[model samples]
Target: MSDWAYSDVVPWWPYVFILLGGWLPTDVWRYIGVVSASRIDETGEAATIARTIATSLVAAVIAQLVFYPSGALADIPTWVRVVALCIGFAAYQLSRRKILAGIFAAEIVIGIWALAPGLG
Candidate 1:
């Protein structure tokens, strides 16, 4: 086993391991993206495809979190979650597709539901 695996002997080793294992790999891709970003045409077919795929992945994750949630989210009622999602989508559309508006609207619904007596 690595020294990082045994925290008692080397507490700082875990941070080093995280830097090497996690940050370095992701940072390399980010650097590459930044370097190549200027060369990529935003309205090009490749960019459109990439955006579509990214959006699909986000939608899939959101669906998973709403429909098959774990922990605290799972504890909340499914109907409430669905309603929040709908409201959030509506808010996003109404706010000219502002991401933060959608998120805040959803969060507000969840918060109100949590605070309201016997609704959770």
Candidate 2:
């Protein structure tokens, strides 16, 4: 059984691992959060701290992706990424901090950069 789990004899083994190892663990937490959400106080200090931490983590991830990217993103020049970030931030600010607007603006810039010849 262990050998079969590691071998390619079962093509769907990896999918089973993904469902068990990845999805199930996260889904448990999501279900718990959903069940307990009504008990959370939105205006409480704990909530405020959670929000701050979440925002900081997101910002850190963005910074890491832009400054030290891997894989396909690494192929794009740093200047292009910075320009896209700037445009996206400006769009977000101008659109009253709409996240989709910022994301769309950044995507448009990156798409253009990828498509245009001699731009990268």
Candidate 3:
């Protein structure tokens, strides 16, 4: 933003380095997951529990974003988000558990809602 934050103060490659620094931890987990999977049983109860927990965590995040969102999402009516999510869930279940169908339906609904002139 200023000369004080230039190459002399913050260095020329700080942004590049910072980007790599943030990615390192994610890569570490990816490598660990690959290594661990080879050693663990795929059908084991612990693995099942871990997968369930991960799914629950993701679902919780999706619910929170739909119910109590922030930033631009906070601008959209709560009712819209709720209705979209409900449609998505029903689509997901009705499509014989097809995840992509649910995602597509939900996204299409949101896009249509966002495009409606009266929304503003």
Q: How many clashes does each candidate structure show, in the order listed?
A: 0, 0, 0
Question: How high is the lDDT of residue 41 in model 2?
Answer: 100
Model 3: CA > 4 A from native? 1-6, 115-120
Instruction: Give me the candidate number with maximum TM-score.
Output: 1
Model 2 residue runs over 4 Å out of place are 1-16, 115-118
- Cα displacement (angstroms), candidate 1, residue 41, comes to 1.6
Flag clash pairs in model 2.
none
Candidates sorted by TM-score, best first? 1, 2, 3
Per-prediction TM-score? 0.84, 0.78, 0.75
Error of 3 at 39 (Å): 1.8
**Candidate 3 accuracy as TM-score:** 0.75
RMSD of each: 3.2, 3.2, 3.4
- For 32-94, candidate 3 gives per-residue lDDT tens digits of 998888888879999999999999999899989998899999988888888888888899999
lDDT of 1 by residue, 1-120 (tens): 655556787789889999999999999999999999999999999999999999999999999999999998999999999999999999999999998999999999999999999886
Candidate 3 residue-wise lDDT at 39: 88
2 versus 3: better lDDT goes to: 2
Q: Write down the worst ten-residue block by lDDT for model 3.
A: 1-10
